[model samples]
Structure formats: structure tokens, C-alpha cells
Target chain A: MRLELVKRPQHSALFSAVSPFIALALTMIAGAIMFSLLGKNPLDALYYYFIDPLRETWSLHELAVKAAPLILIAVGLSVCFLSNNWNIGAEGQFIAGAIAGGILPVVFPHVQNVMVLPLMLVMGIAGGAAYAAVPALLKARFNTNEILTSLMLVYVAQLFLDWLVRGPWRDPGGMNFPETRDFHPYAVLPELMPSAGRANWGIVFALVAALILWFVLRRTLKGFEIRVLGQSPRAGRFAGFSASRMVMVSFLISGGLAGLAGISEVAGTIGQLQPSISPGYGFTAIIVAFLGRLNPLGIVAAGFVLALSYLGGEAAQISIGLSDKAARAFQGMLLFFVLGCDTLIHYRIRLAHSAPSKRTDVPQPSEPAEVA
Target chain B: MLESILITIATAATPLLIAAIGELVVERSGVLNLGVEGMMVMGAVTGFGVTVTTGSPWLGVLAAVLVGAAFSLLFGFLTLTLVTNQVATGLALTLLGLGVSGMIGEAFIGMPGIKLGSIAIPILSDLPYVGRFLFRQDPLFYVSILLVAGVAWFLFYTRAGLTLRSVGDNHDSAHALGISVIAVRYGAVAFGGACAGLAGAYLSLVYTPQWIENMTAGRGWIALALVVFASWRPWRVLAGAYLFGAVSIGQLHAQAIGVSVPSQFLSALPYLATIAVLVLISRNRRLTMVNTPACLGRPFVPAR
Candidate 1:
């Protein structure tokens, strides 16, 4: 039998609410199968992968730490994706932000004051926005494909980061390692509740960003413009929304947020600039954005879910000797199911035995007798 | 030494050429499968694994092609049959491919790989320079060139090619004309996947002859850029691939010669050159618009 999708008269609200949950369940089933194939007890592996991490205060803090960047970056991506601007190079932007933020700590270790941290955060956002501007400017000026240009920059950004930590930014006091100097106490992001765990203000930043963006997207004209431009550029243009300007606005917003995530990751988690600063948070955020259905509030929840996968990967690695790469594979499968289930929103899928007819130019659906 | 460098450049160019040509057809048929990187990597791992276990490069190549095509069918089923968002689905495919390949390839890591030896035409192998360059290269090298020529002919000169192009240019019209838009897209996507697989196979069997996680190393993406750089023309893809191949190999040579510049800068040349070339080409809006498929990246749902 072949699958046929009949368009629903309107988008199904029921499926819209349930698809993500359905997708998550499907992923867990697939993960269990994968674990069994690898010769582990599927039940135990699943528990460690999903439940074990949530039980501990430290792991929960770790979850917050991981989710902070994802929520922040994905919230930004939600804006870009909503506006029909595909900024696939957020990874590069994240690295650029980290490098930019690290400069204060690495280059000016003597500037150990409250002002330094604030200045570094500003610089990080600017750096990411500046990096993202390359593709935005290219697209606006030259009608270039932003997807390719943005993605290409990711490699450039990565290499630039590699050059920095190894070259000029290397910690002078430390042996010749590839990492830069550690941030001074004043430069480090203040912890949220150090007594409880290592969670910092990064999660607070993520929540605030999400709440503000949610308000903007839900209750503001800018959100309307992004939706209009995304669905129909012609309609958006007719409505006086400049597509080119929107490109810049959306890119800047997303880039700035991605930069925030990068710096937060460095100051909050890593505490130094290094040859590598992120573990593909930018890329993972893309998945998070989609899984969240491009809703800022939804992204906060999705971020925690994806963060759990990372934690689960680590937990599985320790307890079951499963490869950490399995986590990525699991994530990839999650996205596939998410997208597949999203089909339920717009159409009713039917398993049919065969086509009704082989003839071309069939009559309208209203003429039911023609098919028979 | 010059001949050896040329050979290396050709080897570098071949994978790009193969992958781009395949994607060119896919785009010409109006589907953008962004998972070329993913498919290529999967191909590399499968090719390496099969070669290691089965002891034949040909078998390895065959398995890679089949696996790539099979992997792409997941995309086909999702975007084509289920009508998921092509961009998101393609990204999913790539992410999944990378993750799965990394897991599978963990076993093959650091294992000595069996290289696919070059072809040796009895009389041609002995010639001073051009003969070896032309005829004494690996089998896939000739396949790459032939693919360019064959795809160019098939796309520009064949009736079937016209049908595929028409589908890409306007799927609604094609569907109205009784052509199976979805079927044609499935075929194009599969062909792209197979070529990507072969390119991945080339990497593992011929280029470096080993399994490295992410060895495709954004080459699949570079190949995607090459398609746009070529403006969907098969012949131009050949030129663009070599241009990139030369840039990449030149950087390697530069690093080997120990140029004062940082090795990272030298290594980043290919990606930088891609941006430059994209800017130069995309500056001519008229050219890009005229060549790009009208229905490219737009999902199609046929009405009953």
C-alpha cells in the first residue's frame, strides 16, 4: 500500500498540539530498539538515558546549563526561520561570539571589574551580529543564497577560532596549550545558586529572552510581519513590509542571541576561550527550533528535552558503554519523526491499495461518479 | 612532481564533481536535498566498512552507492511522499547520517584501510605525463569525467532530460500535463544520493583510503555550493570543482611548504573561496534567476 495525503480543510489544531509528543514517543521507541541492537537491556538503558539525569540536583543544574544556550539560540532561530531567513551558520556565529566575549578576559586580564563582564557581553552580541551580517548583506545586496553563504561562514568562523586560541589568545601563564587564559572572577558569569549546583544566570537569561520574544512574536506587529513574509513574500510586500529589511532585522536578532549563547557558554560553563567552545549547540538549536514549532515559549520546553538527550548520552556512556554518538543519532531520529508527524497538521494520511484510475485530467473531486 | 600534484588535484576534484553533478540533476528536477554531506559521509563509512570486511573496493563502492540511494529514499519518502518541509527534512537526513555514521565508523577508526588502486592501461601507463594523468587514474576518476559528459548530454540533449527539467521548472504544470512530478523527483533525488555515495566512496577508497568521522568535512556542502557556482550547468560544475579542488590542494601544499601564515588560515582557503565565488556569481542576478529552477525547494502536492 502507498501513503496518500488528503489535504484537511483547515490545519488540525489537535495534531498541532500532539505531534511533538508523538514524535518524542516514537524517538524513545526507536532508541530502545537501537539499544537492544547494541546488546544492552533496553529498559535499563532507556531509564538511564531519560529518567536518571532528572533525579539529581546536579544533573538538573547541568540540564539548565545545557538548555540555556539551546533555548537562547533557538529562540533567535525561531525569529529567523519565521521570517523565511535561513541562517544555518549560527554555529559560526556562536564561535564568533565566544571569541569576541573572550577577548576581554584573554586580552585584558587586568580589567577585573563589573564593567568588564557587561562590556564583554555587549561585544559578544555585536560580534555574532556582525558575523551574521555578512550573509544578510550579501543576500540583500547581491540576491545571494543566504543558506550557502551562511553555512560557508561556519567553517571560516571555526578556523578563525582555532587560530585565535592557539595563537595570540593562548594563556601565557599556562604551558603552550590551545586554550586561552581562564576568565577572572569578575569576568565570569555569576552563579544562580552555587549551593544547589553549578547552574548560573545563563538559564535566567534564556528564560527572559524567551519571555520577551514570546511577547513580541505573540503581541506585536513585528511577529505579524515575519509570519506574513514567511508565508507569502508577495503578500508581505503588498502589505508594506520590506523583505530586505526584514532579512537584516531577523538575522541581527538571531545572530545577537546566538552570540549571547556563545558568551554564556564560555563565561558560564567553559570559563575560557578555546580552540573549540561549543559542542554543536548552534546546529542542535535548529532541531530544537523545529521541535518547538518555532514558538519561543515552546522552545524553552524543547530546549530542556534536547538538553536531557545530551545528559542521557553521557549517562548511557558511563553506565552501559554506549557510544555518545548514539545521542546524536537519537536526536537525528527525533527530528525525522518530528517532521514526519508534522504532516498530520495539514493533511490526513490514508494507506491506499491503488490509484483510482490511470487517466490524466481527472474530473473535480465534487464529481464523485467520474472516479467509479 | 607537477604530474603528481595534478593527479592529487584531480582526485580532490572528482568527488566534488560527482556530487555536484548529481545535485545539479536533483535541482534541475526541482528538489533541494541539503543532506548531500550526510549521504556522502554515510557512503564513506559504508564503503570503508564493506571494503574492510569483504576485501574488495568494487564491492565497497557498490554497497556505498546502494546505501546512499537507500538513505536518500528516507528523504524521498518524507519530502516526496509525506510532503514534509524539504529544508528541514534534508537537514534531518544529514544530522542522522552524520550521527549514525559516526557510531558505525567508531569500530573502523584507526584501522588500516584498503585503497582502491589506480587503473593501468598497458601502453598508456608508461607515457611521459598526460597518459598517466588521463588513463592511469583510479576507475572513479574516469567515471567522474564520464558522468559530467553523460549528465550534460542527458540533461541538454535527451527527451527524458527535458521532461525532468520541465518538472523542476514548474511542477504544477508538469502535473497538469499528466507527468508524475513526485515520481520524477524521487528518481532525481535517488540519482543524487547515488552520486553522493560514489563521491563518499571515492573519499574512503581513493582519496584518503580510511574512515574518518566527518571526512566529507563539509565537502558535500562545498559540492552544493559548486552546483550554484555552476549555475546548474554540468560542464560548469566540472570547472568549479577543479577550481575548488585546486584551492583546497593548493592550501595543503602551502602548509607543507611551511608558509609563514598560520596553518588554520591556509586550511580555511577553500571555504573562503566559496564565499568569494558565490558573491561574484550571485552578483549577476539575471544569470542566477535565469538558470535557477523556478520550483526549486518548493514542495509539490498534486490535486486529484
Candidate 2:
């Protein structure tokens, strides 16, 4: 006996739309089983994991804060992924952005001007874009694999950041700790409402970025080029769209956003350059990009969902004594289920007695026949 | 002093050689598993935990291999049976491994580990320069060399290897020839997983002999890059691994010698070298394309 995936004549749009929900449902079921195995009450664990995080005003603010970076990075990643350009080193770009944005506050700690914040943001974007261009240039000029190159850069960026904080950029009066001095008031990102919660302009930046990306991806000719080029580069070439140019453009956009996210994280929340600023936001955003089905608007919702999981993970850790590792495993499981369910959007799984006899409908040799 | 440094390089290179060789086979069978780092960390934690519990490094090694293989099976089920996107599924596998291993290893953290002691072959071990570097190394070091030799022969000389390569080169043709592409791929992926697990075990059991969160660090990723750097050849993987090992160890040595470069920059050397080697090797498109698994990363579904 064998099982096979038969390609659908046309992908089910409805399933494409609903697949994320299906995946989330499956993940919850799996999470329940995991909780049971861990000897926790499944209902209580589930509530803490999914619902409890959103119940409070403060938690909701935290959710927005966490979601800001994910949405920004995921939005950029959606553009890159859609164009078949993989930029797995958004983490590196994020760090670069933070480092770049921090130069003003770190080097000129006494500066106090309104333009400081705006200039820092621009520098952050530029830093990220410049860093991303390394892999982009390599892919365009030499056809090197972006996945490997981009990922390798992540470690480099990390080590560089570690070095700076521990050495050259270390604060003079920080009591020997490996961190920079706190940003001045003019350099810091002001909170949205000082009295309410910790949420700041980062969330606002995420929303604006999403809206702009949606317009660019859906209503513009460049958007059409990206969609066409991503689906079929050959077709894109015939349409006069340069794949190499798109590679650069997609990478720059993604890297720029990632950098923006990094600086926002530093200025808005951390308030200082440190050894570890991100909690894998760049990598987590990859999940968000896919979860949102690589759509900018969809990414906004997906970002919030993932952000909630991070908060829930903390909650579960405190309340049920669930290990942080378990929370990560839960996230990984969600991604696995998401990818599996996504397969259902384009293919139908069926049991077959044998391989050769079951695949008669597809006459084209180019199509994948049986996935068993 | 030089011989000791060489020994350190070899010890560092062993894990990479083992992991890359396993991945080489998986890629030869046309499946690209990007979760090597995740699997390696899973192995590191599992091996440490088991060794600490059982008081036997062998059991720890065995458990690590099993855990790694099991993790790969999850990947196989998704990519092979469910026909999920290989890249996405591989990344998910990695995330899952890191998370699960972290959870399982929480208790084991800070616990002292028993190292897998080196073997000494009497006169050979006592011999001057080459003695400690070769004959007196840990059992896994010799195993890694043998594994490389065995894989090189198996890939180039055996009929089964031919089938695996054919499956990787073009799965549809291999399927038409009754190669059982899916079965071969599953076996290959499992083999890769087991090797990755063994590498992880080497880290905790021999390298550091203690449990540390993410102790494997980015070595798993370096292994993946080594496979590409070798252009899918076993001998080249051996060379690449050792080169990487030297660069990694050399950085520490440089820092110790006060090379004036920041220790952080020195620490970043191995990763930077990986990028450089990739760029250099990939510059020649023909060489890369020739040895490259033609159907690599593509989801294979057997049909008539």
C-alpha cells in the first residue's frame, strides 16, 4: 500500500485562505497533547498559551510591541520570498541596523536635537540595506546561493555586535557590564501613550510599512513584476523584468525593513546597544511571512498571532513551569503544521495500491506525479 | 606545540566531517535537509543528558544517534509523505529540534559530563609527533575517517550508490527505472540524521564534556556549507572540514598570541571563511553544476 499526493488541476483558493486557521487548530490539538504529556492540565495550559496573554491591557501592549518587529521584517521578507529571493540573514541585517542607528547616540551621547531620531532611523535602514546588498551582489554577479551566504553573515553580525559592546562601544560608567550608554531623550522613541503602556512608535511604523508594502505589491507594476518573476522567472524575463535587478531590489527592501526593526527595538525598548537585542525576531518572522501566505496585510495579522505566542510562552513558563524550550518546540510544531497544511492547498493526498496505475490524469511530463 | 595544535584541529574537524558526509549522501539522494544545526544541538543535549544519566558515553552516543534519526524522520514524513516544501519543512525541523532539545536539556545544564576518552595503541600511541595526533585520538575520530572512506567508496563504487545518485540526478528517470526513489531518499535522510546526532554527541561527550545550551552553536551550519564547499565530493568535504577546523582553532590561537585583531573578529573567522570559500567555489558555475544534485531541494512524488 502507498500514499501519494496528486496535484490539483487548480489550487483551491478557499483552502489557501483557510489553511492558516487549519494549521493553527492542528497546532493547538498537538499542543494539548504535549501539555498532557508534560503532566499539566491541558485546558489550563491551553488557556495560558493562547488566551491568557491577550486578556490584559498591559499584555496587549506587549503583544503590539513584540509584533512590531515581526511585522516589519515579515513584510520585507514577503517581498523577497515572493520574488524567489531568500534572505535568511535578516537577523544580521537587524543587528547591522541597530549598530548603524546606535552610532549617533553611542558616539555623540550629548547630542540633543529633534532630527536625531529621524536620522537614526534612516541610518538604520541604510545599514540594513547595505548589509543585505553583499549577498544580493554575490547572487547577481556570481550566482552564489543566498541562503547560505545570508545565514553565514548572521554569525558575523552577531560576533561583531558582541565585540563592539564588549570593547569599543562599552559604556564608560556602566559598571564594567558589556553594554552601551542609554539613549538620550531626543534619541529615544517616545511611547504612544506615556500613562497607558510600553507600546511605542515601532508599532506605528509596522502599520505604515505594511500599508505601503500592500500598495506596492498589489497596485503597482513593480508588484506585478515580482509576482510574475517569482512564479516563473522565464516568463518574467520575456516580460523584460530583470531577475538580477529584482534580487537587489527585494533584498534591499527586506534588509532595510529588518534594519528598521532592529533600531526600533534598540531605541524604543532596549534603550541601549547590548550583546543580545533580538530574541530571534528575524528568524521568527520567516514563519510569520509564510503563515501570512507571504501577503503584506496577512503578515500584519500573522505577526500579532506569533507575538501572542511569545507572550504566551512566557506566561506558560511562569504559570505552569513549562520550559522555554517547550515553547520553542511549540512554535516549531506550528510551522511544521503550517507547511503541511499548505501542501493541501495545492495537492490532494490519496491512498493508492501502486504508483504507476494511479497517475493518469496529468498528461504533462513536467508535473510531479507521486509524492509518497 | 605544532602537533598539539594539529590534534586540536583534527578534533574540531571530526564532527564536521561526520555531519557533512551524512548530508552529502542525503543530497546525493536528492533531499536537502537544512535542519542540520537543529539536529546537531538535539544530539548534543540528548547525548549529554544520557551520558550523565547512564554513566556510559556509549549509551549517550547511541541515544543521540537515535534522537537525531527520529528528528529526521519527522522531516522525512513531512517532505516525503506529505509533499511539503523541503526548505520550509527543513527549517521547521531545525526550530523543533532546538526547542525540544532546549527543554529536555534544562535539567542537565550545569551538570558535569563524562568525556569519551581517547584510545591508545601502545607503541603507536607512544610514537613522537604523529602518535597523539592519529592513533591516540578518540574512537569517533577514527570512525569519522573510516566513515569518509566508506562513503567515498559507497558513493563511487557501489550499485546502491549508483541508484542513489541516479535518484538525485533525476528522480523521475530513477523512478521509471524502478529505483524506489522515496525509499532511497528516506534511508539517505535517516543516515544524515544519525550522523548529525553522532556529531552532536561528539561535542558534548568529547569536545567540552559538559551540557551548554546551543553548544553546537553554528557548527551544524558550517557543516552544511562544507558540503557545498566540497561540491558534493567526500574527499573535498574532508579537506574543507579540516580547513574550517584550522581556521576555527587558529582564531583562538591568534587571540592567545595577541594578534592585535579583536577576539570577536577572530571568533568570526570560521564563518567568514565559509562565505569566502562558497563564493570562490560557486564562481565556477560548471564545476558546481557538474557535482551538484540536479534534483536537489525539489519535492519528489513518484508517478507513472
DockQ numbers for every candidate?
0.54, 0.58
Docking class of 1: medium
Question: What is the C-alpha local distance difference test score of each model?
Answer: 0.91, 0.90
lDDT of 2 by residue, B1-304 (tens): 9899999999899999999999999999989898999899999999999999989999999999999999898999998888776777887888788888888889998998999999988899888889989899999999999999999999999998899999998988998887888999999999999999999999999989998887887898889999989999999999999999999999988999999999989888898898899899989989998988888887776665
RMSD per model, one decimal: 3.8, 2.2
Instruction: Show where candidate 1 strays beyond 4 Å.
Output: A357-372
Which regions of candidate 2 fall more than 4 Å away from where they truly are? A354-357, A363-372
Candidate 1 per-residue C-alpha lDDT over A1-372 given as tens digits, one digit per residue, 9 for 90 to 100: 878777777789999999999999999999999999989999999999999999999999999999999999999999998888889899999998888888888888988878998998999999999999999999989878788889889999999999988898888887999888889998899889899888898999999999999999999998899888877787888999999998899999999999999999999898998888887899999999999999999999999999999999999999989999999999999999999999999888987777733435432221000000
Per-residue CA lDDT of model 2 for A1-372, tens digit only, reads: 777777888889989999999999999999999889988898999899889998888889999999999999999999998888888899999999999999999999888899999999999999999999999999999888888889889999999999999999999999999999999999999999878889999999999999999999999999999988887788888999999999999999999999999999999999999999998999899999999999999999999999988999999989989876677888888899899899888888777775346446752333321110
lDDT of 1 by residue, B1-304 (tens): 8888889899999999999999999999989999999999999999999999999999999999999999999999998888887888888999999999999999999999999998888897788977778889999999999999999999999999999999999888999899999999999999999999999999999999999999999999999999999999999999999999999999999999999999999988899899999989999979988998988887787777
Look at candidate 2 and tell me the lDDT of residue A78. Answer: 95
